[model samples]
Target: MRVYVAKSGDSLLKISETHKIDLNKLLIVNPHISSPMMNITGSKVYFPSSPISDTLQTPISECPLPSPSDLLSSWIPLTSLEQMADTDYDVLIVGSGAGGGSVLRRLAEQWLNSGKKVGMIEAGSLLLPTHVRNIPTVNDTRFSQYFHTVSKWTGKYLPDFPGARQLFALGGRTLFWGMSAPRMDDSEFFDWPMPLKEMKYYYNIAEKIMRVSTAYMEGSSIQEILLKRLHENGFPEARDVPTPADLEVTKYGQIHSDVFWSSISALAYALNRMPFDLAVNARAVEVIVEQNEVVGIRVMSPNKRAYVLKAKTIVLSGSTFETPRLLLHSGIKGRAIGHYLTNHSLLLATAKVSRQQFPEVLGTLSIFIPQTKKHLYQIQMGGPGGEDQWYLWYSQYEEKALLDELLIGISAFGKVESRFENYITLDPNKQDKYGVPKINVNFSYSKQDTEIIHQMAAALNQVSSAMQAPLIVPNNRQAICLMPPGGDYHEVGTCRMGDDPHTSVTNRYGQVHGVAGLYVADNSVFPSMGAANPTLTTVALSIRTADYIVNQLK
Candidate 1:
């Protein structure tokens, strides 16, 4: 028998997997180990001396082979750009955010064992395997610090949109999103090229996979009282926010470690159904087009080497900023490639409610006021404290000094009209290390938009007054602060969808206008996202686009 010494963090199951031996066989050989799942660190474990297989006779090999696990990543397979250039892919998705992830997941489910080659390339490296909230060690404060370290404050360069920040990672911005998954108002979708009925069908599927739930405020007394107060007051439509959070209990072998769903969740689902090649730090410099037909992509490695990846179908999900930059930089012809930029105009305020307002059992308050025909903005109210608020990475409960105040964060998002003046253009003067042109944002509010912002601010005042929680202005802050244009991180419509090629970048199916086999499936495709958060709609449209690509392949 082979005597193998265990190192730190080595478990019996991991050892059995590393040595290609069954758990029972390892247990039989060494009775000292209590369980197969127990960690055996700095200890000797007897392994099966000879290799065995399911065949009648003992399995023998003439040539020695390395471990089956991927050296770069054990959870999912990773291939280099050099290797990817050798094979043609049926579908190659750019970006790994909500849109790109949903597309990959749906395609993997629909094309399982179909012998189709699907690949994905991300310009950023693997930042986190799951949503930051799923990590146990990351509390709200820690998360804030870590996020600042990993994300790029791109807004610093855009004078008009100073609040914009970019996160280039596997899961994208969903890693730190508020998780409030609200669909756009039915009227808001009126201008979109896609049908409303079809949108509803896909929305249902997206909700199921993302685990949208109102169970968060189930037993919270604070929410109960606050909700009742808002309903009785002018705002009767106030209710618990639908968050894409998996709160189900883990049973059997299924571990529900993913409390908050993100694009990494989608990636995991896709990998389970089918195998796909993934390459991080691989940037798509240009989309190769020939006579108005898509051919492949010119991708660059981190080391400045370029590789030509042949893919008949390419979906650009690099987001509102990056997608349009790629299209314009690649010289793809389209009038609306980088126009009609839109985002929710946000306002922030906080208030302190008396602790005597609710019962002794005080829980967090999280509610949303949806957009209505009369009101063009939506409101999100949450929290019982500044640091000890709900929906953090990992909540903590501890005894502290008694207080008579309840801290609540109030925010409103007003619908910004999609306009040609508000656009993103390639800044040829500035370039990254890869020679990719940086983006220059040109944005401002119109008279109508300013009116809406004023309305939103008034609504906040009214809501706060109605709740008996007067809005409080902190030191060096105004009574109601209007967040910067890009602060909401909801930018969209740069490459909007429409029937007219002269006015839009992608068509109804997310395919790039006048370019065969090229598609755009991120927030950039939204004609008008309204006051709703763009995550859910982005995913739904992506799923539809993936289906379109699948049907086209057949």
Candidate 2:
């Protein structure tokens, strides 16, 4: 395939005609390149068809030509017919969230050193803080969008789906996470078909590369109170034992701190450190599989333009919904492609507390409550920016002077036992622009989950009574915190990892057992939802996968 750049007079239509390719076809490859209404100048465009033989020899000196292998080939879209085909890569890592981002960085470093090409593809458009803050409506919560989507409550009981649940931006959801990095309980791994010892080492390696820190929690009032209460109430504190220099801080501190200070942004800044190519705003529509082995990925961009990224190794890090949707569209159905989906359950119970100011809480410093005894064991912490409004009240919305106190938002997360009832399916008639089926995420709570919520709420109420703070449940008027499937970016367990490929999509190493050079390194591969945030574990698995790949290459 050949590349082209635009001149002052080159409109997409004119380019297609001059290159002898269909104009309509050209529009497909460059859907979003156009602005909200018209085309934006100096924006990179991708044409769908290949260049004609006559047009290939016509070189314009105004536009610089680059080698096909060069990462920045050209800004022009494909314009020639018959040459619009898929490109191949040594490794094609999908998604760009925690799992995909880490693996891409690691592989890019290794591949650059080895003089091999590695390709990283992200479905969402690249996220920029400057662009977000510039937008008028979203400026106030620009930070939230920078990180992850907000949670919503449905009715008074069920979970509500938020308009902004998942952020489809360049860094994936890492931009919004509170950076709570806790390792999965040994029991969580024991339940899986793989050995826990191997996973532990991987987790350690990932934590190190991420530079997880606990310094953010040093003087946090919320962490202190929660830790003291847990200890005083006979609950166990997060393990804070010392480790070697190689393993610096406590796992809890390493995982849960602010992800704004994460390695992801650094990798983005060091894009030149990569050997192959990183394509943002490119959405993978389907995986090219032949004879049960993965071959390549077909993607569609905002311009409705289609292309392929063929690879010897294919990694699906498109999170839960996207990964499964891609596989299903690719006709690689499995027993667990979209089953066992789980996310942390949250409830926003506000109250009028005696204290006007809420405690200065560190993100993710939760009180761990064990469920063995069944007195409502949970990990509770402040909600997104809830600490800021702790002492403020709504003078306009509520009874003015009756209760002008601060509101605290606490999230109670517990174990979500797997259930087949909660799963993902393709919407029958709803097709995306690519003509692929849109995902229908069926997020329902099992009796066990509902019971757990009840138990957690009861325990929280007990704490409130002790503090003499009257609980103020949000009116069933609208959803607040408790939201349905895909609410939080913590979705996992679709392409599960286990010992048996017959039952699991990928093996413990994240390799698709039946297919060589195919791996699933994102949250979708988790076999079980541990009672902790999944980012740390996902990062660990990505690091582990990178090491395995590096060793294999050696």
lDDT of 2 by residue, 52-108 (tens): 434554777877778665653333111111132344566777777778878877776
Runs off by more than 4 Å, candidate 1? 1-75, 387-393, 396-402
lDDT of 1: 0.88
Q: Which pairs, if any, clash in model 1?
A: none
Which candidate number would show the highest TM-score if scored against the true structure?
A: 1
Query: Residue-wise lDDT of candidate 1 within 253-282, one digit each (tens)?
Result: 899988898999999999999989999999
Weakest 10 consecutive residues of candidate 2 by summed lDDT: 238-247
RMSD of 1: 10.6
Tell me, by lDDT, which candidate is best: 1
TM-score of each: 0.87, 0.69
